[model samples]
Every structure is written in C-alpha cells, then in structure tokens.
Target chain A: MNLREVGLRDGLQLEAPIPLAAKLDILDAVAATGVRRVEVTSFVSPAAVPALADAEQLAAELGRWPDLAFSALVAGRGGARRAVAAGMADLEYVISASDGHSLANARRTTDEAVAAVPDIAKLAHDSGGRLEAILAVAWDCPFDGRTAVSRIVDLARRAVDLGADELCFGDTIGTTVPGRVTELLGRVREACPDVELGVHFHNTRGSGLACVLAALQAGITKIDASAGGLGGCPFAPGASGNIATEEVVYLLEESGVDTGVDLGKVLEAAAVVERAVGHELPSNLFRAGGPNRPRGRG
Target chain B: MNLREVGLRDGLQLEAPIPLAAKLDILDAVAATGVRRVEVTSFVSPAAVPALADAEQLAAELGRWPDLAFSALVAGRGGARRAVAAGMADLEYVISASDGHSLANARRTTDEAVAAVPDIAKLAHDSGGRLEAILAVAWDCPFDGRTAVSRIVDLARRAVDLGADELCFGDTIGTTVPGRVTELLGRVREACPDVELGVHFHNTRGSGLACVLAALQAGITKIDASAGGLGGCPFAPGASGNIATEEVVYLLEESGVDTGVDLGKVLEAAAVVERAVGHELPSNLFRAGGPNRPRGRG
Candidate 1:
C-alpha cells in the first residue's frame, strides 16, 4: 500500500503552464499529508513539456523538504544528465513497449531503448544519482495489438541488471485488466524475485484501481498515482493520465492496506490544485469529498 | 458470466437523452450481442425521466428480440401496474436500504418500503409478471453513512418470502470496494442460499469493474451495466453511471469468462450512442477500442 504521489510530474505533463511557485505550494501541501515520496518533475524538453519547464527550479526548490524524497522523470541520456544536474538524485526513466509508440515517442526501437538503459544508468551512477526503469505499455499497447509478457520480463530483467534501483510497468493507455496484470507480474516475480516492482497505471479505460489490486496480489508493493488523474499520454491521442492519488489512497486504506496518507488532508490539497487549475481536476475524492467529510461543508 | 445490460433504466436516469429511437437501436444492438437480459426502462412519471418518456413504445418495439428477457424498473404499485400494462413481464421493484434515501426517493421509511413490497409483488404476479425485489444502496448508502449487512439480508429474506423471483443489489453511488463487496455478498449468500442474485454497480468512484470481479468471485452470475455510462444518481451528486457495458464485456472476455457478447460489436453500438448524445461517452472500450481489433481502426 506504499504509493508514490506522481501528480507533479505525470499530472503536470499533460496540462498547460503551472508556475514553479504554484507547484511548490502543491508539493508543500502534499508533504504535509504524509506522502513521503513524490515525483516532482520531468527533465524533458521545455518546448515539448512547457508545463514542466521549471523542472530544474522545482527540483532545486525541493531541497527545502528534507523529510520527503523527491524524484524526476527522464526519457533519454540527455534528460538523465539534466535531471542529475538539477539535483535530482532519483530518476524514473521510461521506454515504450509498443513499437509504434516507441518510435514516435522516443525515436528508438525496443532494443535501442534497452541499450540506452545501461548508458543512462552509468551516467546516473557517475553523477551520484539513482535510476528506476519503467517500461510503458507493458500490458496492452494502443499502437500494437498485445504486448507480450516475455518482452516486458526481458526489459525488466535487463533494466535491473543494468543497475536500475526499481522496475515499474505502465499500462500506458489503460488497456490492461486484472488477468493481464496478474499474468505479467507473475512472470516478473518469477524472473526477478529480488528487484522491487512498482506499477504505474492510467484510468483512461477505467481499470487503474483493479490493476493496483492485481499488482498487490501478485506480490508487488509500489504504485504510481497522479493527484486528480491529471496526466495523459502526449504521444497517444485521447489517452488519459495515471490513477488519482486520493482514489488510490481510499482504495488502499479501505482494503486494510496501510497507505499512511491522511485522506481528508490529501483531498484538501487536491482541491487547492483543482482551484489553481481553473477547472475540476479528475480526482474523485476531491470532487466527492472524503469518506468522513460531508459533501457541501467546507 | 451473464451480464444484464441496464443502460436504458439506470443509465438514462441521468441527464443524457439517449433518444427512444436510439434506445431501441441500442437494445437491438445489445440483443444482437447475445446478452440474456436487458433492463429496458423504468416505468415512472415521464416528468421525472423524460429520457424514457416513450417507454411503452420502446417495449413494444423490442418484441422481436425474444431471446433477450426485458425488464423494467418500478418504485411502487403504480409503476408496477404501468410496467405490467405495457407488456413487461419482469418488474424490478426497488427500495433503498438506507432510510434517508428510502424516505427521500420513495417517500417511505425502510420498514414501510418493505411492507409495501408484498402487495406490489402480488400485483405484478397476479397479472402474470415476475418480480425481482432490488435492494438499492446495498453496499454503502450516500444518505445513511454505512448500511448494515443484516439490514440488507433481512430485507432480502422478507422480499423472497413475499414472492420475489430474484434479488438484485446495487453498489449504489459506487462506494463499494472489493473487500466490502466480498463481505456484503457473503452475508447475502449466508442468508438466502437459493435466491438468484444479481449485481448493479455504478462507476462513480472508479471501483466498478473491481467490484464486478469481486462479485463474480462471490459466485454472482448476473451483473448490470450501462452502455456509454449514461446514468447518474440524483441523490449521490457527481457520481457517474453504472459500469460501462463495453468495459465489462472486455474484462469478462479477456479473463476467460463466457459472457457470450461480442465486445467489438458492443463498442460499435457504444460509438453510435456516443455520437447521438453529442458528447464522448465515458466507456473505456468505446474510446480505446477492443483489444482484438486492429490497432488504429478506432
């Protein structure tokens, strides 16, 4: 039930400009809710992700929160170097499972992406930072038909061998169900028993929480969730973002899994971001209020 | 894995005006997909539900789908009479388990609602129609904080005693999670072993499909879903519709459950309804397309 709040990175990636100061305010609020780990920003091109142009500034500002561990997203060697330079000692690197999305998104074949992993890892190690590899579209690929379990396992094994601190899989476009999640995670567990596994899910097709439950059952411990489900795939049109943090926390706590997040306070933080965004964010708990809070009051 | 499509009844209770002609078209599509049962409409004052104003006409048009057992929703004796008179032989008589919703929606206490069920059952049965006593808000009530399993089971027992042919429980407002679903279904199974059970769920809080999986594991053979997720709870503000039919069919078929519905075709029908409503429907399969279909056709 230990979940990483990914809203600042995943949620902001799909939106318009969010000031670094406003994002800092969000980070401060999230930290107070007892969510220790937060993916703060991605070191992608400012032109590509103008919303996260302040990645370096954001990561630098994060030095103020000594109790919280903040990470940044990086897609390539250059981005990894930038993330390290920005003072982000922890990095989540991604490569797509789908051939079409892989070529279109990162301009590389699967093998090329795998080859880049070691280089990125080496750079991170030399820079005194750590790297986590996340294979996107690990279950069902929107551009390809079905992503083979063998392929994802191979990627995970290679990533771990290449010095990845953790291996996370993404249902990039949310096409996965519990069966697929269990099947893939089972394979991952069998092949790489010692590596920590995390699941990153999108609620685009609405199987996000179901996938979380499946991942938990399959013996995986970590999950990636957005606050208000604010991220969508920049490469895949119509693709939505990661699961909401509030929704995930509610599910985890209700199932007797300890998420260590205060639901009411998290919802309040989500509300602040929603108001800052000028439209309702996709977080369900923020909209519906928490389990104990009355809907219309405060 | 028999799915009971309830879009016309539960889905239409919201603001979406799935036209009567489109309703029949969707019904025809559902029947063609090999669904065994479809809840066509609720025989209420058209004033309350202008969407189903042509309920009588729609039912008459569905006479040709002999294999699809049509059902209608009824809240009281008058609605039951209207359904029977319109040639619907199966009436789903509903009462909320929560006293607050029972009093607000039906203008009766929980006890009074239970007391009235017998007469309504007799009226429908005397007219050669079958009655299915539906217990709404079975998992968690939006009005009355948390509903007890004993209260639901007792009401279910009394309903069966009064001549209910089947029992259906709604995850009203979509507050149900997998653990809660397991506990609630276990209570019902313990209380009424022989009673055929059905599940009606909403996707308001994003756990509908997981709840469906839990229900299936609990040995529930029947489920309720809406096409394109058109329903909303008037009492539970901001909640979405029932589980989308396309998404449920995808999950069931992907998981090796024989739902007997061509999920690809179901998405086609969902697309039509989505277009008719002049807004993109919330159904995952409709937007993401089916897994087996060729990758970019959708």
Candidate 2:
C-alpha cells in the first residue's frame, strides 16, 4: 500500500504559520520516515492561506530530497505555471463535485472546474510535469448534504479524459463511512480501470481507517494521511484530524497488508510536528506511545 | 441491527465511583432512548471493582423497565447465582482466550474459566435465566499478541456445547480490523450455525464501526455500545471509548440497516451521561451537533 504524506501541505493549510526552517525540517524528517511520496506544498495564493506562503521557498529548498517524489496542489493555470516553474514534476489540481462546494472552494461551478482542467493539464504537460486531479468533497459536500456517486464518477471520467494521470477522492469533511467508500470508489474504479484511484479521509467521525479498509477492499492503493493526524476541515467545523500516517501503517501492517512505511520513524516525525504545532496532535497511536499511556498493550 | 448499551455496565466499570442514584437515572434515560436491550450492570464482586458496586441495587431497581430487555455480566458460579437471585434473566459469562488476561481479570486460567461455564449456565438455566458466553480477546489480547482464530472457534463450540444460548466475540483490545473480523467471525458462524453470534468492539484503534459493518455483512446482529463512547478496557489500558450508541445507530440507519434506536433520544441520553461523568464524551456525532459544528452536510 502507498500512503502519501500530506502532513505538510494539506495539514498545515489550516494550521498557524510554521517557520520556513521548521517546515523544511518537518519535510526532511517526514522523508526520513521512508514515505516515498510527500505532498510538499499547495501553490495557492499566499493571501488565501498565509500559513503556506512559503510554498515557493519550500519547493526551492525541498530539492534536498531528490529520492522522495514531491507533489503540490495547484488551483488553476496561474498556479500551475508557478508549480511548473518551481521545477516540480508532479502537480495536483483541485475541484469539488457539487457546485456549492466548488463555488466556495474555487469561486467556480463544477462545470467550470471541469472545463478548465484540460487547459491546466495541457499547460502542465507542456512543461514536462504530470497532472492529477483531486476531486474534493467527492462523497459528502459541506454545502450539499451528500454528493452523488455518479457525479464523482463523471468527474473521474472527465479528469482522466483531460490528461489526469491519476484521480484522488477527498472526503474533505471526514463524514464518509465504509459503505459510501465502497460504493463511490467502486464505481470510479469500474469506470476507469487503468486510472489510479486514491482516497483522502478525515477522522472527524473516527471512521477514517475503516474507510481506508473499505477503499483497499475496493482496490484503492493510494491513501492520503497526515503525520500526527494534523489538519482540520474549515468547512466541517471542529472536524479536524486526517487519518494519522502512523495509525494507517499500524492498521495495514497488523492486518497483514504490506505497507513500506516504517511506523517507528512515522512516530518520530509525529513528535516533531507535535512540538512544532505546540499542541497534542489527534493521532490515536501517537498518544498511545506517550507518557500519558498507562501500562498495558497498545 | 440490535445495539446493546454497555455504558451502565462495561462503561461504568472503568470509571470513578458513580452514585447509585445517578446510575439509575442514566439507566432510565438510556431506556428512554429506545434501546431495546441494555447491559445494565455487572454481577462481579463489589470488592473487586467499586465502580459497579451498585449492580445488585441497580438490578433490583431496574425491574421498572420491563419493556426493555436487560442483561448483566456474570463472572462465574457465584456471580451467576447472584444474577439469578436478582431475577436477571440474561447473563453474559465471560472468559478470555488468553490465559494471561483471564488471570489478570479474574485470577483464573483460561481453561479454568471455561471449565466453570457449564456450571454457571446450568445454574442460570435452573433459575429460569438464559446464559451467554462472551469470548473476550477473541481477536487480540493485551498480554497475548495474536489470539488464534482456531482457539476462538473451539471456545465458541465448547460454550455452545455447554448449553450457552448465544455466543459473543469481544474485541477487548479494539485491534481487530475488517479482514480478521470477516475471517474469524465467518468461521465462528459456520462452525456454530445454530448459535446466535454477537460482536463487541472497542474503538481503541478506530476500526470499531468498520468491524461492525463487516460483522453485519457476515450475518451478526448483536453489538455492544456505550453512550457517548465512554469506557476503557481495564486490561487494555489505552483502549478507551467503545463505539458510541448514537454513532453506531447513525451509521447503521444511514446505510439502510434497521437499528431500532432513536438517534435524537440517544443524543439526549448522551447529554445526561456527559453531565454525570463530568467530562465530554468521545463520540464524534455527539460533538458535531454541539456549538463546534458548522453549517454543512452531516
């Protein structure tokens, strides 16, 4: 199983600013944890999310770990230009399935976002970078109650047709259950057998790992996790904590699923984020190993 | 799907002293939530765990809710004697598959505990009561790393042979994922086709509800949950928070499974438990409805 460490970009998107030095340090530490891929930074405007204002600086300095595959989130053609100019090879474009969420997220409707992907993908490909489309709120929309599974499948089809090398379904609000994961991801996988499908889940309902299991059973291999369960969904208020990478590793490995991630190193990286964030992270396995843990089996 | 509310028994067993009056009030409120069954109290010795010392008092007073079926945890012959004496009809006799946990919990070896179940069942039956055997640590044990699936099945068969009316598998450590759950529970159901099987899970590893879905898919109808996700496994120290009543009902009902539980009333009961425990409970849906929630899809 492949877990993309999104603790830095998607994680810090909602967090207070961490110094550039600290961000790089966490990036280096996360790479050291044997996470082969890391979503380094989102190339959105700094004014929109000031915390990740160091995206350009991070992409510049992050050439330090050439062995680690790095990816960034780009909003549109302009953001794609910045990411390609920054010498990043993998770029992720974002859109929402529902028009309400699409407007709130990108100030455009779902049709507009889909219509723009071809140009964005062509621009990225012209610059020698691979583009993948992330369908945010694919399962549950913050504005709309439940996003239709067919809508997500249509987006997957459209994204793949528009040169999306891969497709990722983001449960931005963390409200997805196993059955929905099976239903939606199953359809997406069926519609696009050659395309790679990934799942991004939040642990607000505490079913994140379970949703991961359902996704895996449905043949999804790529999952997005934060190092210390860091990150919150601003839309789904009080809905914070992506599934921790360490917790995901524990669940997968213990269930006889081979995940190349080193759990011990993931914990160390979690510690660094905990200290940097200046608060306890919401990871279950992270706290289970801390001083607050009573004597017994984990 | 039938949810057995374990908040009053399995939940309070690990908490600080809760006055008998408060326990009865919570029990009344829990019944008001439309839960058909409630594992109200344990018949263990009062000296062992003082938190549940009022079990006999609760059972004596709880005859008020005859419309709601009640069950209790009975350790051995003595506990069964007391349960039958209290006119409690449904008794859950427990033994761990791992000798270490059995000794730590009841000061008896696993085999010794199993050997005593027939007598306990006979006593309960002779007194017009039905007895069920819960195989604790059926999946994972704190002291023992991995409990063999064959050993759990053998125990289930033995318990059934000893006139046990039903079989329940307890994930006392909350570590069982969906695969193991499907595999082990599937085997148990096959090996004991005549026996009704139940599953009890903790949310320690955050796979509780997923395990529930897997179990239901495997034909299990009985589950144990605590209101507000309260309660920690005393043996599995870090294993706090059982799958919450409201959360389970929401998941099941949303997926088109009939749970027969009132979600609105469960939240009300959760509020009462939150106030009595003097701390916020660990349920996600419970907090989602509070001040922390933002306007969006559930």
Which candidate's lDDT is highest? 2
Candidate 2: TM-score? 0.93
lDDT of the candidates, in the order given: 0.77, 0.81
lDDT for A259 in candidate 2 is 90
Per-candidate interface C-alpha RMSD? 5.9, 5.2
Clashing pairs in 1: A228-A283, A231-A241
lDDT of 1 by residue, B70-168 (tens): 888888888888888888888898878989878877789888878878888887788787889889888776678788888999989988988898899
Error of 1 at A225 (Å): 0.6
Summarize candidate 2's per-residue lDDT along A58-92 as a digit string, tens digits.
88997688788888998888898888888777889
RMSD of 1: 3.6
In terms of TM-score, how similar is model 1 to the real structure? 0.91
Docking verdict class for candidate 2: acceptable
A278 in model 2: Cα distance from truth in Å?
1.9
> In DockQ terms, which candidate is top?
1
The local lDDT score (0 to 100) that residue B89 gets in candidate 1 is: 83
